[model samples]
Target: MSLYSRKAARLQLNLRKVAVKGGLAIGAAQAANAALQAAFIVILARLLSPADFGLTAMVFPIVFFVTMLQEGGLTSAVIQRETISHRELSSLFWINAAIGLALALLLCAGAPLVATFYHEPRVEGLTMASGGLVLLGALAVQHLALLNRNMHYGRMAFIDVTAAFVGFIVAIAVAAAYHSYWAIWLRGFVTIAMTFVLAWLLSGWTPGRLAPVSQIRDLIGFGGNMTAFSLCNYASRNLDNVLIGKFSGEVSLGLYDRAYRIVTLPLLLINAPLNRIITPVLSRTRDQEERYRNAFLSTLQMGLLVTVPLMSFIAGNSKGVILLLLGPDWIDAAPICAWLSVATLLQLAGNPMGWLYISQGRSRDLMLAGVANSMFICLAFVAGLPWGALGVAKAYAFCAFLSTPLLFWWATRRGPVSLRNLVGAISPFALVAGCCLVVVHLLQRSRPDTGLLFLMELLTASYATMVLTLSVTRTGRSCLAQAWSVAVSGFSMMQMRKRSSYG
Candidate 1:
């Protein structure tokens, strides 16, 4: 009675509390995962060469794009739907299983071609390893979705953290033993494989006999549009790596890839956890305009609060961070990291706009926006090819920010969340972030030879600026109070649960 059977009557009554606790649970898990990942990347960078990372980066876009499409976008559909049946879920499960196996074989077959495309012979085998990871991911997507649909994030979080820990131990051990990039690929495979095992165990789900395909036609329709968006957005975001690798070579791609991995850590931390909670929460509240609007805006502000300062510091102090994390060999990645951080800030501004679209069943809009954005970014890549890796970085950042306004208008024009709402929510943080970034950039230039102590001062001054700005404004105070209450309430709720279990 897993996917086919869930009793959600009581859960429907207090989605707010569920969302709040779920966010806290997943947030804590991701924070741990981020720390693990950051350490892994840093250590691996010192042990391996840039070309090692570059080869993996080259094939990842294709593998990741398929990963997004494997569930046929059914996971989010399952979460957002008002009702789903056992038969329908079972049908979706079998469908996912079939697609996964087919995609695995396809990736394995195409590995040689990927190797051919980049003129890098080593990637052929790496792509095949990624195929195994794909198969594991497809098998578990439905089970994980079942858990997500019911907002069982506490259990899911525990499973996720455990998988990440296992991946960390295994990857590092392999890297230490083999001194190869296979360790990086193994990290992906092990994490997905472990998550699949634990998800089935903890998801309390056992798929029943398959139902007729007709029963899930509407779900397929919903998911198909999402799949289209995934395809376009994948091209938009990942094509840069492909372009750089193919034209500028592995060393260039590797440096850019390392810089990118380091700079985008905060975005992943904020986006991944909130995404798990907010999509389902917003989906449930979509019928209530006020509740829906408040939930989306509150989530947007909170994310910006974490991301802006972090991105600003990284963009402004890329040199110090590079030296500290990756050593002198990767010092060349500093400017590339800075530009990528700017692009990330722009990309992140529209991240939650996706929650708005999915909750409102606007996948078609999402797809169109993705296509248009992809077209522009692709042009930017082509235009920058003559200038090598740094040129590509600069061009990508400028084009992404240029395209963001249109994306905002397109995403919010018809929804309950309007353009004005989004602009207002982001403007204050943007202002504060810009000021702090400028201040830090000037200071860093003036003290070019300073060490970690200087980084501390910059961090302190950045947060101080944010706090002062927020403290002075009514809206900022409201947001801070709301954030504080959520934190306190989530902690209290956990303690109560522990006490009840002990009794």
Candidate 2:
């Protein structure tokens, strides 16, 4: 029933082909983007200060909160609709544009208030400069959504990476030249410009005119629940930023934000590519109950398998990861990174549930689940306020993990991916991580000058390698083989392109 089975049937075969090609393209694009971003972060952190990073961090969450209004799932609505009209697309585009303009003005007006909230007068100007990205982002929404609906990811990949590269270059240059928060603002401006360029280049089709009132109304209703769910999800994820800025100060917020970035980076890497590829695919087979069931389970299986080891390794080697990746200045982030890494890993278990809901047209359930999750998280944050950043992270992670079963129960209706499947998927990495912890402790017998940092790295690397090695079993071997094939094919294509150009 699933479009993705081990068997080499025709439909499965074709789906695999599409997934292989699309995933590889998006994955490579993301890798380039991540590498560029990492370079920017590293260089910028050195050139700039934690205070600078924190200031940008302080401005971003408020900006993001406003920007989320522009995205209200109109793109996904476009994608999920089996037959979209020119009128519908055109109408959505205009609506998003108007929303973007309003949000831009709103952001400008709120800058003073935002600055007041953080007690940082500097934030007012920074926000005013950065607020334009919302309108820029809004402008491209319908165009980008149309591309996703068509599953034109190869084009999408090119557009995204090119824009990101431009943004990074602008930021780095501005940072080097001015050595001011202007670099932060420039990143947004350049990103928006690049997006506009790419949107125009990739989206060959253009809007004609707005749809009729009735047509627009229908699409809005369809997208409403998805929008509501997204809003709640955004707030829940961003609670820490708001709390840190309010209680701990900008510098503290900066530290926590950097740590949060390190923890969630892997998830972003996974989610961006997988979500792009999976959602459309899921939408295609939504009506076929058996197909939906299988696709959903396969996705969950892969998500768990990948998420666990990464989280385990990070949690086990938090100290070294922080020092090596972020530099010695970020030593304060080690514990926060460790706990939040665990939290994100736990969060991955529920990742596919929303997709399943959307595919099944259970939008109300999606919104309800999101609201519940967000409310729970907010309450947890309030309770943990006294303990500071680490306490907040600890509390957040606990709440996220606790919500997994509830999410699963909602998604499955007590069907496949039962408690046993969940445990089985998670247990391997957890067990390995525990073993790595023991080894780390043993190596820390003398507690060398570097302390647990060096020892933890060795322990984690060894454990992760072993976990991966054991994955050579029948079921695991197949997935590994497929992944390997995808990687090889992608690299080969790149090499071929290079050779042809040179010759």
- List candidate 1 stretches off by more than 4 Å: 1-13, 495-503
1-503 per-residue lDDT for model 2 (tens digits): 56554443565556655766787788888888778777776777767777887888888877777777887778777877778899889889888888889888988998999899889899999888756788888889988888778778899889888888898988998889889867976777787778877886788978787778886675687678888988888888888888877888777777788888777776777776788887787777765555655665556555555655666667766777677667899888889888887788777767767676666566778888889988998888877768888888889889887887787777666433355555554455455445555554455444543535564556556556645654745445554555466568667767887899999
lDDT of 2: 0.74
lDDT of 1 at 69: 75
lDDT of 1 by residue, 1-503 (tens): 56422334344447868887888889999899899988998899977899989888998898888898787989978988889888888888888888999999999999899888888899999888788888899889889999998889999899889999999999899889989988888888899999999988998777888777787887898899889888888887788899899988889999999998987798779988888889988887687677688889988888888888888888889999899888899989999999988999887787777898888888788888878888998899888878888888899899988998998999988868888988878877877778778888888888885487888898777777787778777778887888788789888988999999999
Which is the leading candidate under TM-score? 1
Question: TM-score per candidate, in order?
Answer: 0.95, 0.88
Q: Would you list the C-alpha lDDT of every candidate in the order shown?
A: 0.86, 0.74
TM-score of 1: 0.95
- Candidate that would win on lDDT: 1
